[model samples]
Each structure stands twice: as structure tokens, then as C-alpha cells.
Target: MKKGMTWLAAMAVCVTLAAPAQAADPIKIGVQGAQSGDLASYGVPSLNAVKIVVDEANAKGGLLGRTIEVVAQDDQCKPEMATNAATKLISDKVDAVVGPICSGPTKASLPMFQEAALIAVSPTATTPGLTEDGKNPLFFRTVANDNAQASLTSDFMLNNLKVKKVAYLHDNGDYGKGFADKNREIMEKGGTETVLFEAVTPDAVDFSAVVRKLRRAKPDIIVFGGYQPVASKLLQQMRRDNLKTPLIGPDGVKDETFLKMTGKDSEGTYASYPKDTSTLPEYKKAREAHIKAFGSEPGFGYYNAYAAAQCLLAAMEKAGSTDTAKIKDVLRENQVDTPLGKLSFNAKGDAAGMGLSIYQVKDGKFVELDHSIVLE
Candidate 1:
């Protein structure tokens, strides 16, 4: 009996010693956004949110027993810089990329990611051209396209505000131009003529010339398609020139930074946002945690970034692999619950059922209106 027990113990020891230990490779997620530039307001908050999501996941044993690491790059809101950042990430062997925030940069870097078979998700790149024909298989966005906001803005202007003519101004970049063009099309179709269309250089210190032109045209409303920095400067200049025609803007201007820039000037100014969920229980909890880490509330773009990070990690967990193809398949087959509510991507990599709602700057805050327009 003693000899038989010894033999069994020896066999168990040999089997245990022969088994190979599993390797714990860190999963790397590349985060590209404007860390320094006018658009940093959009990028910085989103990145902070991404960090929160990653940290939370890491705290819970991570996904698939691997620690997640985020390698962030500053695109500086430039196209060439974005391409270079993507190349660096590819060389670094990142599992996925989370951004390229602005539309131009996103467009520029998307082909590289597609060629490399690396999945990318954009939180703020809202141009309709990105997924128009359903060509991009490896790219996705949490935010709705500009068409969604354009529809809401056009409908609100024509049906509610009763604005017959609008003066359209854009900053000549992909994001600004896309919004301006889509808004023009939607407004024209809704019986609102675009009286004056002009392009302004982004980051121009003085908009006196543009203001003078707008004052002469005197449309019922003025719509500016650009980031908050330019939008605020132009709005301030318009106020100085006394061209207050109830200025409105796209999601780019629906930010606290814009409110601080314009102060009382931002009052009565309307902007369309993805949606406001400040009152939701999930959002409240998330925002509290965010404030504890970042000292502020989440912005319009933050929710999308946070959602993208969570969705990416969740996909990896579901697939039990960091392979891009598996993650992409999981993304298509699953719905992710986030602070922004339930999210699912469509065939074109656009967030299905994602929509927009209008917000008016009132008392130094963006207050959601009772209306919303959804474009699936």
C-alpha cells in the first residue's frame, strides 16, 4: 500500500511540473487625440475618460487575465500628425486604437488602420463621409454622424424658430465643412435658404471682416461650423459688431469650454449635442467618479470615448482574445451598455439608433430642450 501511494504521488508531481504556465501579456490600446490644440478640449476629456475605463477594468483582474495598457498619442488635431501617430502605434503593436478625434485626422488615419487590420473606434469624428458607403470594416464611432445633428438643427430652425434664412460659415476643415454642407442641404430642403456661405481660417484672431460681411447680409440666424475656440471668438466678434442674429452651432460648440469663453454672450445661443444624460443614474455615478479623478464633469465627447474603451475591452473579454478580427466580430454582434445608454454599431460602423438633441446656453450652462431628432 505504501509503494502504490508513492507511485501515485510521483506521477502527480511529474504531471504538474510538465505543464507550461500561461503567459500574461499586457493588452495595449492606442489612444490618439488632440492633446495640445484648440480641439484639445474635446480630446483631453475623452482621454481622461478612457483612462478611467481602463483603470476600472484593470482593477477587476482585467480582461482575459491580461493587464490593459493605454498608449496615448497627441495628434495635435492635424492630419499628417495623425497619420504619423497611427504609424507609430502600428509599429508599437497596439491591439486597437481609440481615436483620431477630428474628422480630417480620422479620415486620414483610417485607411492605415484598415490596411493593418487594426480596429479603431472614434469618439468624436462625426463626418458622414467616414461611413457613407459602408466601406470601412475596421472603424467605428460612438457618436452619431453629422447628418443626425444636421437634421435636428434644420428642423428646429425651420419648424420651431421659424428662421427663413441662415448665414452659413465654416472653418474649411473636414469637420467644419462636413457640418456646414450637411446643414446647408438639410436647411435648403426644409425651405430655409442659405443666404451667405463663407469660409474662415481656423484660429484667426480677428473675425472683424467676417462679422462685417455677416452684418451686411443680416440673415435671420447665423450658423458657424467649427470648434469652440473659433466659434467663441467669432461669436464675441459678432457681439462686438452687433450682429446678434441668434447664433447657432453644431456639437463642436456644445461644451463647457465654450460657455466659459462666451459667458453671457453664450446665452440664447443654441447648439446641438449627442444627448444630455446628466440626470441619469448611471451618468451621475460615472460623473461623480470622473470628478473625483479629473476635477470636473464629463463633456459631450467624453461619454463616447468612455463607451468606446468599455466596448473594446468588453469585446476582447467576450472573444477571449485580443485579435482585431475577433474584436470586430464581437462588436458587430453585441450591444454595449454605457453611461450614454445602450450602444450598438450598424453595418457601416456607425452607432445604431444614436441621435442628437438641441441644447441652449442658459445661465452659463447647456440646458437640454424638450426636442430631439434621431437619424438611424
Candidate 2:
């Protein structure tokens, strides 16, 4: 009887000792993006970027000695699909989430993330509505919103290009319409005339009809608001039609796909993006690691995604707990040094003092022209 009692006590002590270890499970970070839709070029790279950061964090002993696990889902660029993905992540009880690259999907899925009290951070969603509503305090973005890019692009057109009269062509998506409206507002305010504004479906390859209308306007320039694939098609059609006006667009049209799709027609096309690649020693080191891990060059969205992940990890470290509320507060207050320079969120969960860079496609690559912060 005495021997049995001693054995039982030893077993109980072992169980108690193992309890803490069992409770220290890996922390899961959910990533939502359009992995299989028209935006896959952006989404896949963005997802890989998140993976690189999480892997590096784990290799360096992770956050508070807990390994980071990425749980990714394809939102497919649809609102319903995005909401479903958000719900799935919330059901899995993720510590935080890192995307739905497109603006429409992000806006549609915001409510689900807010209800779950999850810290939803986006690397590429740039619609002004996300931040303008003053709702979803949990929402955060690393990229400059469309409003900034629009104002900058508008200013460039009016002052430098001396393009007083311009025509606007947008894909009519959330991203397209948002940029068009904001650019029009700012261009008019800046003393430039917008002669025509036209919207077209994103998947429509035959933009000759739209091109005809734009040519009729006979504006000095045409500004397109859409991604590379559609933008490439439109530009190709414009070239085929012998339109010579300079074509300007937002970051959505800035990618290798754009160049490939538009062929040699991409030359001289302008895009507004975040600042030129940060070559600071720290960012250089991180970039090296990223290239080594992914075995490829990171895109514009990659750096932003990496920054978002680092910010989340930093917040988790500061809080010393995975509690969403505490992490949110910590993130709002802390300034993390990332590849994109210092990152700090404001009351609206926007990266404080962020700006856009203007670039032109020269020799089949995005060449930085000017890096400027939009003053609100």
C-alpha cells in the first residue's frame, strides 16, 4: 500500500510538471489572400513573405518561446469567400491575421474579424473606406491608402507632366473606383481638368471601345486604375490603336506581369507606390534572408507583408501574452524597425506618417522617380 501511494504521487507530480508545456502550444497567425484568383501574383508573393517572416521568427526562438504557425486561406477575391475565410480563421482561434490583399475583400471581411476581436492587418489593401469609417479599430494596414496615391499621382500629372486635361479609365472594382474618385477630387482641387471618366469590367480584354471614347476626349494623358493583367490588355489595345498619350496608373499596375502582358508597350507607363526599396543595413540583412529563404526576389507587397508580421510579433512580445486586446494596445503604441523603416500605428491603426513613391516603367522595370509622403 505504501509503495503504491508513492508511485501515485510521482505520477501526479509528473502530470503537473507537463501541464505548462502542454499549455504552451504554438501561436497561429492567420493569413487571408486571393491565392487562386486574378490577384494571385500579389497574393502568392504576399503569403510567401509572411511565411518567411514567421520562419525567421521561429528560428530565432519565436515570440516568448512559442513557435509561430501560419494558417493561410484563399479568399479568391470575392466578398463572400473572404468572409468565409475570415470566419474559418476566427474559428481556429488565430492570434492575429495578415491579409486579404484586395480592398473589396478586406472591406467585406472586416466585420467578421471585428466580431472575433482579432487584430486584422493588411499588407496591400489600400481603399480609403477601410480607415475612413472609424469602425473596426482592430483593422490595420502597412501600405499607404488609395487617397495618398491618388493625390500624389494627381499632383504629378498637373505640375510635372503639365497634363492639364486628362481622361480616367478604371476597372470599376473597389480599388478602381476608389482611386478614380479620389484622383478626380484631388486633380480638380489641384487645378487640372479631368475631361472624361470611364469604367470597364476587369476581365474584358477588348478595351477598344473604351479606348475610342478616351481618344474622342483627346486628353493629354490617360490614368488607369486596375492591376497588371487588365492594365496590360488596355495598354496593348491603346498601342494597337496608335494612341500616344502617356499612361499613368497606381501600384496595382506595377508588376512583372504588367510588363510581360503589355510587352514593349509598358515603357514610360507611370505608377505610384511606396518609397523605393529601403537599403538600410537592417533591411538589407532582412532582404538577404528573405531572398535566401524564398529563393526569389520579393515584390513591393512582400516588404509590407514582412513588416506587418514583424509588427505583430513585436506586439506579442511586448504584451508577453497572446491576448488580442493587449496585443492591439501594444501594437498601437510600439514602433518596430522593419525593412520599410520604423513602423508605428496611429489611433486609426494606420502606419503613421506613411507615403507613396512615384515610379515609371523604364527598360521593363519600375524606376523610382520621386519618393514623397502625402500630407493630409
Candidate 3:
């Protein structure tokens, strides 16, 4: 009996020693975005969406019996800042990351993330090359690449808008420039003339000179490739210069910030964004929680961010471990029903079925023009 008691005490000591490993503090989730700067509206919403998701997840007793914590790092949508964000997250020992929103930033920092064996799910990075040839196996996204978006835009401009000559303007960054180039290529292939292709300095507040050049081009439509700040300023300057040509844009300018900036001038402006799933229960729940917390509708990429965070958390649960490799496998194989609907990733890390849809500024807000523009 004495020997048995001594052995039992030793066993109890072993159990106590092992408890801490099993009950390690909350799992850390890193969220990277343009938390502050000219693109604050674009980035803050992604953080807010993740916060809402994190809160809901914690409320439900967390995932895999471990509470989740968000470690947000702001990249400010700059390439240099993005590398810094990745370094900090690596130091933080986060299990996964949600974004580095801009394509330039995402491209600059992805190698660091890959080296760290950290899994990432971008809510808005849409460059085509990011996922090609399975280069970044650790990287995944809830957004479609710009290649598909470009195809859709070409079809829309050719078939729906029926424009012949178009002007192309870009911010010269990876996302903006790549999207603009793709659009020009597609439109040219369809026999539409690209009258002018120009890159504007993204930070320049005065675009009157560029607007002047655009006016001389006399394009039927202007395709602006960049975020709302530049787009808004360009549109404002174009209108002020009496160039009433309709300016169409991509997801970067689809936010309410663009609408607020352009005001009356925003009318008839078109942009392509992820298809709306506002009617779905998953989407409704997220929106309700966002409004309850933030007192307004969620901003651009909010739903996509929600979907991203949910995908990460769900993959962790499905894999039954925080091991990124296993979670990555689950992410590929399992379908997660997020605010974006049933979501799964391909080998290239792009989300399946999350195609771009057209939205137009109607009555001071962006309203869905068409969601069924499928491109081969």
C-alpha cells in the first residue's frame, strides 16, 4: 500500500506538470491591414469584422477548448510597413494571420509568412500571381484574383456598357497597375481601343494635370485602378475639369468612402466587388453583430474578413490542432459556410466561387448592378 501511494503521488505530479501544456493561454490570431492612414476606412473594417468574429468565437467557448486572441498589426497599405507587420506577428508567435490588404503589401510580406510556416488568409488581396504555381502554400484568401475580375470588367464594358474607346489610369502599385493592365489587355482583345494608359502618383492630392490629359483623350469611359482616396480625388478633379466621362473602378474603390468623396459626382460610377450574400443567415448574423457593436453597417471587406477569420478558426477546429500544416489541409479539403457562403480554397490559395460582381453608385450609395456576370 505504501509503494502504491508513492507511485500514485508521482503520477499526480506528472499530471499536474502536463496540465499547463494542454491549457496554454489563448491562441493568438494575427490580423494585418491598413489600420491607419489614407486607407483607414478600408482597413479598420477588416479588423472590426475579425473582432466581431473573435468575440462570437470566444462566446461559444472558443475553438478546440482554447480561447482566441487577436493581435492586430497595421501595415498602412505600404510594402515596407507590411514586412514590419509580418516580423511583429512572427515575434508575437501568432498561430495564423488574416491579411495584408493591399496587393503590394501582401506581395512584399508573403515570403516572411511562408518562411515562418504561418498560415494566412487574405480577405482582399487579388493579384493573380500571388497564388500561381502553388508558390505560397501557406497563403489563402477569401477574394478572387484580379484576372477573373478583369475578364468580368471587360465583358461588362463591352456587352453591357458598350463602350468603344476607354482610358486606363492606375496608382502604379501592384494591385492597381496589374488590374489596369489586365483590363486593357482584355478590352484590347475584344477590339476596344485603349486611348490612354497612365499611372498617377498614389499620394498626390492634386490630379488636375492627369485630368487634363484624360480630357484630351476623349475616352467613352475611364477605368480607374486604385483605392478610394486616389479614385475619389481623380474623379473629383475629372469632374471639376469638366470631364464628365463615366469612371469605372475595381473593388478598391467600392467603399462608401468613395461615394462620400464623389458625392453627386459618384452617380453612375461603377465598380466590381465580391458578390453580396446579405440575404444569407451567416451574412445577416455578422452584419447584425457589426451594427450592434459599431453602430453602422460594416464597411468594405467586412464580410470577407469575417469569412477569413471564420475559415481560420474552423480549420483549426477541424484539424484538431493549431499545427498550421494540418489546418492548411483542412482549409483545402473542408468547405466552411461563412458570410461569403460555402467557402473552400484551391491549391493556388484562391477561394472557389467568390467571383466579382458589379456595383453602381445609385442615389448616393453603391447598389448592386449585376451579380451574375460569369466569365469563362
- Candidate number achieving the greatest lDDT relative to the actual structure: 3
Separately for all candidates shown, the number of backbone clashes (residues 3 or more apart, or on different chains) is: 0, 0, 0
Over 4 Å off, model 2: 2-7, 10-14, 374-376
The alpha-carbon lDDT assigned to residue 37 of candidate 1 equals 78
Each prediction's TM-score versus the true structure: 0.92, 0.95, 0.94
On a 0 to 100 scale, what is the lDDT of residue 319 in model 3? 91
For residues 1-376, could you state the per-residue lDDT of candidate 2 as single tens digits? Answer: 9999999999999999899888878899999998887778888877887898898888898888788899998997777798889888999989899997889899999988888888889998988889776897889999888888887888888778887897988888898888888888888887778889988888786888888888888998888887777888888888889987788888888887788778789889999887754766657866787789877777658878888888998899999998999998998899888777777888887777555788998888889886467422
* Best candidate (score: TM-score): 2
Residue-level lDDT tens digits of model 1 in 1-376: 9999999999998877666333566889999989887778889988888889989888998878888898998998899898999999899889999997889899999999999999999988989889877667899998878778787888888888998888999999888888888889988888887789999988689888988888788799987888898899988888877677788788888988998888888889998887766676667767887999978777658888988988898899999899888999999878877877777888888886555789898888889997796545
Model 2, residue 40: displacement in angstroms? 0.9
Clashing pairs in 2: none
lDDT of 3 by residue, 239-356 (tens): 8777899988889889988888889988889888877778889999999999999999999899999999999998999899999989989999888888888888887788885646
Better of 1 and 2 by lDDT: 1
Please rank every candidate by lDDT, starting with the best. 3, 1, 2
